[model samples]
Target: MQYTMPTIFLASGSPRRLELLKNLDLNVRQKKLPFTEKINRRLSSNKIAEEISYYKAKQAITHIKNDEILLTADTIVCKGNEILVKPRNQNEAFEFLTKLSDTSHSVITGVTMGIPNKLSTFSAETKVYFEPLSKQEIHYYVEKYKPLDKAGAYGIQEWIGWSKIFKIEGSFSNVMGLPTHMIHNYLVNWQKS
Candidate 1:
C-alpha cells in the first residue's frame, strides 16, 4: 500500500504539545475541545486519560473537514493509584508538589488520531522521579512559575524541570504532555494506511 500525508489537526490546548509538534516540522492545525476538566473524581487514571482523549477527538471530528486528519491527546499524572491533575490554585499546587517530591510518578498520555471514518487510539507512559524538594523551593516554584495550568503542578521542560527532575524512564515528551516519538510513528503509519 502507498501512503500520502494528510492535513493534520491537533485537538488540544497545550502549548507544549503544540511546540513539540512544530519541532517535528509538521504543518498541523490546532483545535481545543469542549469538555469538562476535572480529575480525582472516581475514574481510574488510565481510563480517564483515554476517555478524555476520545472525547476530545470526537469533539474535533465535528469541526474538522473530511480530508483533515485530527489528533487528540490527554495526559495525566499518577502516583500509585491516585491521579494528580492540574492544580486549581496555589495551595493545591503546593500540596501536589510536596507529595510528588522525591517520589516516582507515572505520566500517561493518551492519543487519538482519525480522519472521518478511520480512528486509532494509543497511550504512552513515562516514569518521572523528582529530587527531594525543599519547602522554600516549592514555594518559590509555585509563586514564580504559576503552574496552575500544568498537571502535577510543574512543567518538565520549565525551570522546575531543569532543577528538580532527577530522572525519567520513558519518552521525555510524554512528561511534557505529549509523546512525540509515539505520535510521529503513529502518524507515519497512519499515513501509510
Candidate 2:
C-alpha cells in the first residue's frame, strides 16, 4: 500500500525526544497524554521500556486523527537486574550515580508509532560506560543538573555524560530517549507502505 507522509503527534513530554524528532525534519506535533507513567518491575529490564511505550501509545489513540500517526516512547536505565528509573530526590540521584560509577549499564528506549488502533513498537539499546565518579562529582551533578525528570537520574547529553561517560555502544539518540536512526528508517519505510 502506498502511503503519503503523515504528521506525527508525539505523545510525550520529553524535551530531548522532541528536539531529536524535530532535528530529523519530520512534521512533528507534540501532544500531551493524560496519564501518569508507571514502570512495571515485573517485566525484565529490556522489556519494560517497550511495554510502557506501548501503553502510552494506546492511551494516545483517542487523540490521534485518522491520517496522523501517534508516537510514544519510554526510556529506562538498567544495571544488571535493576532498573534505575528517574531519581526522586538529590540524595537518590547521588545514589543512582554512585551505582552507575565506573561501570557499564544499558539505556533502552522503547518507541511506538502508528495511527489510532494500529501501532508498532520497538526498542533500541545502548551500552554506556561511565568512568569512576567521585562523590564530589556526583554531588555536583545532582545539584546542578537536577536530573530528577530524566530516566536513570541523568541525561547522556548533559554535563555528567560529558565528564563521566567514557564510551557508548549503539545509538546516541537512543540514550537521549529516542532512537532517531531507527525512527528515520521506520518513517521512511512506513511512508512507503
- State each candidate's clash count: 0, 0
What is candidate 1's lDDT per residue for 1-193, written digit by digit as tens? 7434666788777788889988877777887766675453577676778778877777778778766778888888888987888899999999999999998999999888887767788888999999999999999999999999888889998888999898899999888888899877887887576
Error of 1 at 94 (Å): 0.4
Poorly placed runs, candidate 1 (over 4 Å): 1-4, 38-44
**Every candidate's lDDT:** 0.84, 0.88
Candidate 2, residues 73-140: lDDT per residue as tens digits? 98999999988888889999999999999999999999899876568999999999999999999888
**TM-score of each candidate structure, all chains considered together:** 0.91, 0.94
Off by over 4 Å in 2: 1-4
Cα-lDDT of candidate 1:
0.84
Candidate topping lDDT: 2
Which residue pairs clash in candidate 2? none
The worst-scoring run of ten residues by lDDT in candidate 2 lies at: 1-10
